[model samples]
Target: MCHMTACSLLSYIAIAWLKMVPMQTIRSRVQFMKISTLSLIFCASVVSGNVSLKYLPVSFNQAIGATTPFFTAVFAYLMTQKREAWLTYVTLIPVVTGVVIASGGEPSFHLFGFIMCVAATAARALKSVLQGILLSSEGEKLNSMNLLLYMAPIAVVFLLPATLIMEENVVGITMALAREDTRIVWLLLFNSSLAYFVNLTNFLVTKHTSALTLQVLGNAKGAVAVVISILIFRNPVSVTGMLGYSLTVIGVILYSEAKKRSR
Candidate 1:
């Protein structure tokens, strides 16, 4: 929580120093409301996602997350009534089916965890779609850094109370741990720096592409993370799971090609 807060503060400061837009010019109640809404969704997704991790294996959590594209497509259709190529819809089928197959093979699964994961995934998709819609309007368009500068502080506000309630001893624990291991401090600083970049890039991506495209990329990212984990951690993997993940990757590739050709 502290890391996130620091990163958000740094991002806001960096943007101000760059003079992209005066902080005063960015003030609007409507804009605040929009950013606050996104902050709430972002907070819910992160909290639920982390909570789900306690009850589900990391692999299962990721497998469930890989269904983000499906929800993205559904929400995009419902919200905008936009239609995609038949091939785009066809490619989404395998993307979902593969995740289902992989999740079915998980040795550990809990109903609560499954529900939370689903909620998190849906919220994430909604965030992306809503961000795209919000930024698509000529009146609402703001540069990515400016958007993050505003949104990050709102997120910090939303997260602060929750951190206090849920992690009451976090400060004490961190202080104690940091005394023994200065590496903890360095790691946190590194993490905070990366978090800023993550937020910046996320806004940039949503600005450049539709939410469905971002979700498709997210699905591919999950597959890549799984492969990295298997390689770096020597994690055990079943043949069925491997095959399912392979199918998802292929689907992502096909979906990318279809989207490019459509464009």
Candidate 2:
């Protein structure tokens, strides 16, 4: 939580320094309450994702994450009444089925972790949908940088209290860790700086394409993560699990093609 809060604060500072947005004009352009609500959803997504990694192996966690497009499609329809081509809908079947298969084959399956990952994925999908719906109007619309400018500070405010309440003496713990190894502090700072660009690109992608499309892209990212994590962690993998993951990736590829043809 501390790391995440730091990332939010860092992003806020960077955006302000870059002068990407006019600080005084934000109020005239959009309602603070609306942006604040979206920031809450952003906090939930970040927290749930971080928590799930504690209980689940990266490979398994990312395998489940491959189903994000399925959730995104559902949320996009519910929030925006947007419909995709029938072929696009059909491609989701394998995307969903593969995850079910992978879950059955997973060696270190934690029910609680699974639930958390699902929540994280759903919250992420919801964030994208709500951002589009809430900010689509001409008057309310914000470019990716401006959206991050507003959201970062609001997310920091939302996270600080929760971090303090949930993680006892977080500052003390971090200080102790930093004293033990100065390298940890540098690593954290590097990670937080990277998060700014990640959030910027995420907002940019969602702005340009549909939310469901972003999830389809994320499926490919998860596939890459699966391979990289297995190599780094030496995590055991089963043939069934590999088969299921393969199916999921294939499904995502088909989904992208279907969407392109529809366009």
Candidate 3:
């Protein structure tokens, strides 16, 4: 959770400095405040979901991620007073099915594990739904850069205190910053710059795309992250996991196609 907060802070700094997005508004102060407040809740949920990963298996975490679209549908429906048809509500079937099929398989399933993963999913799904609301409600007022400006840094506030309270070797992180390790620094750099850029891109996508499309794509991001984890972290993958991933992608496509019909 702390780390996610820090990441949000880092993202904020990156967003503020890079300014060329074109979301002009008369209510700059109001919008800023609104954005900041929303982001705080947003960060809490995002951080909570992410931190849950520490206690749960990564694959399990990924499975939790697959629920995001369902949450988004509910949130969007409630906020917009846009009741989905029976088919729209039913779209969840493929989304969840694909996720289950794709989750690579976790060996050590337990009550605690189930609880942790469910909690994580709930957190992330809520966050995703709120973000979609934010996008739908205020996207034109916030291009990618402005969105970053408002959110990335605001997110870090959640992390700083957590770092001080929860973890040891805060000094090490500082010392790590001081060192000339291009490797480690690049990781931070990548997270701050590239990650934030991707976040902004996602905002743009969510704005132009349906909430369901955004979520479907977002799930794909999780799968891609898993692939990256395998490559960079050398995490082992199972055939079931691969199969599950395939199903998830297929399910996402079905959901997207179904969603497209409504639009």
Per-residue C-alpha lDDT of model 2 across residues 40-93, encoded as one tens digit per residue: 888898789889989888988887777777887999888778999999999999
Pairs of residues at least 3 apart in sequence or in different chains that clash in candidate 1: none
* Candidate 3 backbone clash number: 7
Sequence-dependent TM-score of model 2: 0.88
Please give, for residues 68-168, the per-residue lDDT of candidate 1 as tens digits: 76787889999999888888788888878877776665556578998999899999989878877877766777666666666777778878888878887
* Whole-model lDDT values for every prediction: 0.75, 0.79, 0.61
Q: What tens-digit string does per-residue lDDT give for candidate 3 at 1-263?
A: 33444445655455445443443442566666666666676665655555666665565466656666676677667767767667766777766775565443644334565565666566555665555455556433445455555565666665567667877888687567658565766675556565555665676786777556675677677778767756765556567766765666566666667777877
Q: What value of lDDT does candidate 1 attain over all alpha carbons?
A: 0.75
Model 2 residue pairs with clashes: none
- By TM-score: ranked, best first: 2, 1, 3
State the lDDT at 209 in candidate 3. 75
Q: Which residue segments of model 1 deviate by more than 4 Å?
A: 19-24, 201-220
